[model samples]
Target: MSKPGKLIQELNRMVNEQFATPEFHHFLTLPLNRDRARFFVTQSAHYIKNRRDSWGYVQGAAPLDVKAIIWKHEEDELVNDPRCNSDHYTLTVKTGESLGLKREEIDGSEPFPAGRAAFYAWLHLAKDRPWLEAFAASAILERRNNGKIVRGGSLSDRIGKKWVAELGFKWDEMPDMKIHRDADEAHSDLMEMIFNRHVKSASDEDAALRGARESLEIDRAFRGALADAMEKIS
Candidate 1:
């Protein structure tokens, strides 16, 4: 009835699982008062920093066309996307100041060592794997975040809700995150299309599926580690 994908069936199964859990949403919804919110925002900075590093390395190994796509993606991330006047990382740090995070506080000592290692390990996979697989790994993270794909709710929606209920900040108060909340949906969709379109053969599909699976597995650990650290943060 339809074209069979080398990996889409399995990849879709794995991708759906990422959303089927309340774990990610729980991390955001857990009642963190102002002091905890302060820590949560600070910790979020560290996680975004790791995201930048992994994405940069993934772009480094992507095919020319996919690289161009990611380059545009990074324009919002590392460079200016015109959508945002500055990089998202800078936008995030500035957003951090709202919750009382100074640059030094964010950059200051005390990050989760295990989380840090996992970030580097993701980069290694992006750098070492074939272009499709590498790109698939990075793409799945956003796919996991995309509300349209993963179900339950997006990471951004959950985070935004928690902020509203806890901190009393309107959506306009954190403009950058609000934009990413929507834009990442398009990004993840574009990436999944790439995976689907290019898998002309079984092996290509297998590689892409492998990349998606491995990335999702690592992400579960990474999120768990971050949640643990946030829970323990004094």
Candidate 2:
């Protein structure tokens, strides 16, 4: 098989293993309550903002061609998508409304201490690592959220369903979650294309995988922290 194909397989394996981890499963299986839902929606907006910061760092550090790719990826995120009629943060705020959250509440909320640490960890990777590693770290989150890649369902799909079943939310009501459920597939594809185009050497592949693995570890920690916070929301 081709080098990129092999690398993709390796990446897929890493993601699959991530899903199987106890921390991941614990976070996913946590019961959703109204208070928890509000907390999650509010905190996730902060999480999304952290993503914007990390991606900006990555874009600043990337090569010209990779910067172009990152810029295109940011179009649907940072800018208003004519299709959705909103950008990602706005969409999250809209989702927050369903949880009885005001835009101000979400916008003004502080990141939990653990969430703050996780965000900094991600930012460190984006800023300090090689562009390939930084790109891989950011892309792995989307790739993990790709239902086509993850067995059973993606994170967004699973969480969306939980909100519906547990919280009586309509699928259409959570625009941000629904949008990511579909959009990350295309995002993952784009990242994979970049991997294929740029990752030609063993060292490059190792760096990419290292980034993916470390990012996934941080993701698990982030989710675990969220779960802990959710449990305390009563």
Candidate 3:
């Protein structure tokens, strides 16, 4: 059940390469900070917020079935998943309270310019492209986050470890990194299955490749911004 014109294999290759790039390291470095792990945690929250916005745009243009799959994925993101009892944003805020950051700080800090631009660019791509292609961009973003799929560890897991070891955070108490490390595993696998099933013809495949490439380009920049902001904040 692939698309009218899909190229899942090539897109998969491109997306796989994107996962191995240096951008993810740059993005997650903030969480490695001993003095400012909380800032990184908050910044990560912003990153996930951007992800939600991009996913929504993709959902708006995807096929009904794809939309449904993405909607289920959003259950772990926008809505509550029974496994966690909270959405991704709420999870971040919970981490904030633990770090002694005020809720106003979590909810009120506007996204940095770079993060904002990268997000809107992704949203534009998601909104304007063909459904599979658009959906591919958002999927590619998760694939980047799915450290399990990425080879080392997901950014969530690395950040989680950093919060405890490098930052001297309470090893047992960091919920944001703890929960996502497990949840994104399931999310990424589900997305991989979705891609395998839906991408059919060459044209559709090309669109998927386009989505992966464009999103990766922006993601590199997005992650770079996250790292930069973390450094400055620290």
Q: Write down the TM-score of every candidate.
A: 0.86, 0.97, 0.85
Instruction: Evaluate all candidate structures by whole-model CA lDDT and list the values in order.
Output: 0.72, 0.89, 0.72
Superposed model 2: Cα runs more than 4 Å off = none
Per-residue lDDT of candidate 2, residues 78-118 (tens digit): 89766587798999999889878899989889999999999
Look at candidate 1 and give me any clashing residue pairs: none
Q: Which candidate ranks first by TM-score, i.e. highest? A: 2
Greater-TM-score candidate between 1 and 3: 1
TM-score of 2: 0.97
Judge candidate 3 against the unseen true structure and give its global Cα lDDT, from 0 to 1. 0.72
TM-score of 1: 0.86
lDDT of 2: 0.89
Q: How far is candidate 2 from the true structure (C-alpha RMSD, Å)?
A: 0.9
Model 1 / residue 194 / CA error / Å: 2.2
Residue-wise lDDT of candidate 1 within 1-234, one digit each (tens)? 123353555655677787554555456546666676666666667777777777788777666777777877877777775766777767667767777778787777355686777777788777888888888888877876777755566777777777888779787766557767877887787675676566677688777778888888787776666666667755
